[model samples]
Target: MGLRHKKASAGGGHSTSGISPNSTNGTSGTSPDISENRPSWRRDPLEYNLDRSWDINAAPTTRVFNLTSSEIQAAPDGVLRPLFVINGQFPGPLIRVNQGDRVLVNVTNQLSNGTSMHWHGFYQNGTNWMDGTVGITQCAIPPGESFLYDFTVKQFGTYWYHSHFSSQYTDGLVGPFIVHSPEESKIQEMYDYDQVVLLQDYYHDLSAALLPGYLSSGNENAEPLPDNGLIQGTNFFNCSSYDSDSGYACDQNSTRAIFNVAQGKRYRFRLINTGAFGEFQVSIDNHTIQVIEADSTLVHPVTVNRLPIHVAQRYSILFHANQTTTNYWFRARMNDYCFSDQNPVLDTDVRALITYTNSTSDPAPTESVDWTYALDTACEDLAPSSLIPYDPLPAPQVDITYPIEISFQIGDFALDKAYINSTTWVPPAIPTLNQAVAGLQVNNANFTTSGVSTAFDSSQLVIDVPTYKVIDVLINSLDEGAHPFHLHGHQFWIMASGAHGAFNWNSYPTLNMTNPMRRDTITVDAFGWALIRFKADNPGLWALHCHISWHMEAGLLMQFQTRNDIMRGWAVPSDVLALCHVK
Candidate 1:
């Protein structure tokens, strides 16, 4: 069946806030009025909490979400700027659904520019067009138009949705997506409450406004440093850092997000790092958390005082509220060392309040003590080897290997560009999937190959896997900065990773095949390499790229044309193709 955007009923000028009441299964609940422009700090944290009463045992049904993209002037921190919000909320609204449910999101674009929504970590098996990746599966939903993203969520856990068009998500278009399942019943019992904790690096300027300087010549390693960091879309920014006439509307009354819990309860905080550039070291004063899930994969409980989370990565930790009935600090320290340079006005310490019931006062300096463990100097994710999957699924033997080298080089104009091998990606006028399907249907030899495809231009780096096979991808980084690499559509087994050195061809036989932390995102440290394997059974064109927004805009992305044998029989959706017709 074909999918199309249903027009809003006449006389109702599209409600710009809240999920549709007609949604089946469970709705994320009502969101605050976006037109009010109230800062997140003043709003109750419970309003942002996910409703835990969703019936997990209910039969699968379609869950509908109406999301409108528009620009609004607001201050996530204390500094005011124009933010692209969904349903008028900064950290968009929550989308919670059961594992087998179908998700139909009608994304209405009211912004001046085009936009698309990507359900991060969801494998769009037969519905590649629903992937919502601009330049890959489909084109952007042009201004004043809407697109229906219909897909079934086959996996369960914490996921998120964001504007896959350019660096728009960094400007505010982000929200949490949680998939519940009967399989999680055992894990669910350990927590008395569940909620999402968003961590992001806050910038005073819009990403579009900062792109020109970052992409200019002689700025190879310089990424725009954030002015501050945020937890649940709120943080206190010292306005004095900006000059009296700095042309910024600063409000010193901004406060930190407060998460209230009972003294002897357990909380499942699903942490999602939605920032454009910074990696955060997360911790709660005087509390050690048990990490139960990593990137949609349930893992054996691992206790740690502090958690290092890179951009686009997620971790669900269980926090036991066994402390005294008092407020404590919930810290998310931005790892500024990862940036080539720092903003003088930037505050690396980002905090929120973990207050007990009936306690509203802030924690005094001497009252709450942070974890004494030394901070992480390395800009990388927690060791992959340390997190073992709860379910033991041995990785299959590899059938082929593709070694890709990633680096940043100053090109002909002395402009910095990221490269995978010798190719740098520039979004084609037509998506790679559109090109691949047509070529495969015509029985083009180039499109039916087992390696790279020559059917597309040099700007598109596509590796074609014509049939089902266990593939190994060795990603080696040549740059000095650590990168968090995310692969779309599939969660691969992390065979091995190193902070330095090449993947030893001799060590292939000894690599861990006993469920080696299968995840969708991983960090390849500075001058490091990662070996990942996945079965090419899913039919579609998928992207593999750096999750860092600036780095991606610089061209650190590639596509995998998988299961072309199956894609050849597919027909492009008319509604999806319509997006490309817009100017």
Candidate 2:
């Protein structure tokens, strides 16, 4: 119930060399040691050969992964920083499972702090306790305590997993989560090779070290700018850029990640923005990326020279290696507008290499041109119209509508915090899910089905739905900053969005019922409003909040307790029940 930190010494004790024992060793059968496949200057492609395609109704295949959470002295961008790693890797190992498979991740906390792993974009339907959202679904896995995350993968495509407790993930507790389905098998024929490219904004300090300064009074919500950016956990940074007196040990020899491509072959690059903040404009010079998937939605291929991806968003792009045998920059440029505070060592332009040769030696720089299109001036999502899911499924009619407003408030004593309507979230001693189940069994008067909350805990806004209902959420952003709002346990259809003042109720009947962009995370631009609709059929408590680590920590979150009729008699597992009892 309390935020924990493992104090990291501020000297030159970090190293970015060597492979972790838990990393994948480029082999089949038992779980591979993921660090063995860590991206190097001239490493081969990280294969997506794991079996993920299966019949939807077939008996669920159980897959187990041993995830060890520990502290690591890592330099993701050559600047030493303390990272909360998983299985000894900076950007944790990938978890690939079939759409209908049961994923049991046994997580042992070796760090000196509590942690919980949220399966980003996973709909934990019948097993909401496994949603892994600390204080929302269950308590954090206590330090030295082990917890089993058991959930079924209902949806498929490029998704991710990260620490959902406080700002822990920003310090390096993030990784790729790919769910392959029958639909992906049909799309796989379009490309010969599949790989993952992680783009992140790097900081030289632990998030715990930065939180106090950020949360202090009078800061005015100015976000901490990153020291650098990374491509697949590696990038080049000049040691001389930071003064020796600056207190950061910079290694000038740190290498950038390299992807060796065979000429004339087509490759599918799954790009995941796992950074705490910073929307990256990803581009590989002289190459046109044909985007075939957005988040977990498989879409009709849309081509672009550059793709602007916000936090927690994923895109699968296909590109042909038909160019001349030379090295080209694979860029993931962190949007400068996202940073209010600047860092002298920060190079917003993050780059990696795409080489035709297998040599680790640096290749001769070749001339490459960026597309002529103007860059996006606003931090918004890629247009919803451009992405149409290949398998068109019409959105169901809304049974009820909830018009909510999200804003930031400078509370008493000038402390800045975010709010969803009147409730500014603070972690409950017992999860809302646990509270709801207990309340429902006793028929607590505060609990209701499908309407406004009746609970009086101003900090915990619980939307109680006794039965299944189709809900429409019209989200209005009262703040000046754009927020990437993500919903747990379900993907919603983007019915309508506008940068204008409000959602005109007059246009309700004219909304699109045909297939719209259905994704788990969406952005509501500054002073903008977006109407999203989803069927609240998933049975359990789900957290809907901004994906920004800073904002979420500042109380920008709310929960929905759906299908309480099914939850009243249910009981949370003993292992999960035990986490709350730890001191």
Error of 2 at 338 (Å): 3.1
Instruction: List the candidate 2 regions with Cα displacement exceeding 4 Å.
Output: 1-60, 359-366
lDDT of 2 by residue, 97-191 (tens): 66777677888899888899998888887888999999978899888889988777888888898998899999888888877666666787797
The lDDT of model 2 is 0.77
Estimate, for each residue in 1-583, the C-alpha lDDT of model 1 and write its tens digit.
0001112230112212336222311212112232134554233344556666667777777777899999988887879898888877777877877877777899999999989999999999899999989999999999999999888889999999999998899999998888888888888889877778889988888899998998898876478778999887888899999998889999896767777777687888899999888889999998899999999999999999999999999999998888877778989998866666657899898998777744446797777889999888788788888899998899999999999999989988899898999998888879988888888778888888789888899999999999999999999988888888999999999999998889899999999887899999998888889999999999999999998888888899999989887898998899988889977
Name model 1 segments beyond 4 Å from true: 1-44
Model 2 TM-score is 0.90
Root-mean-square deviation of every model: 7.3, 7.1
Best by TM-score: 1
Whole-model lDDT per candidate? 0.84, 0.77
Best by lDDT: 1
Model 2 / residue 164 / CA error / Å: 0.9
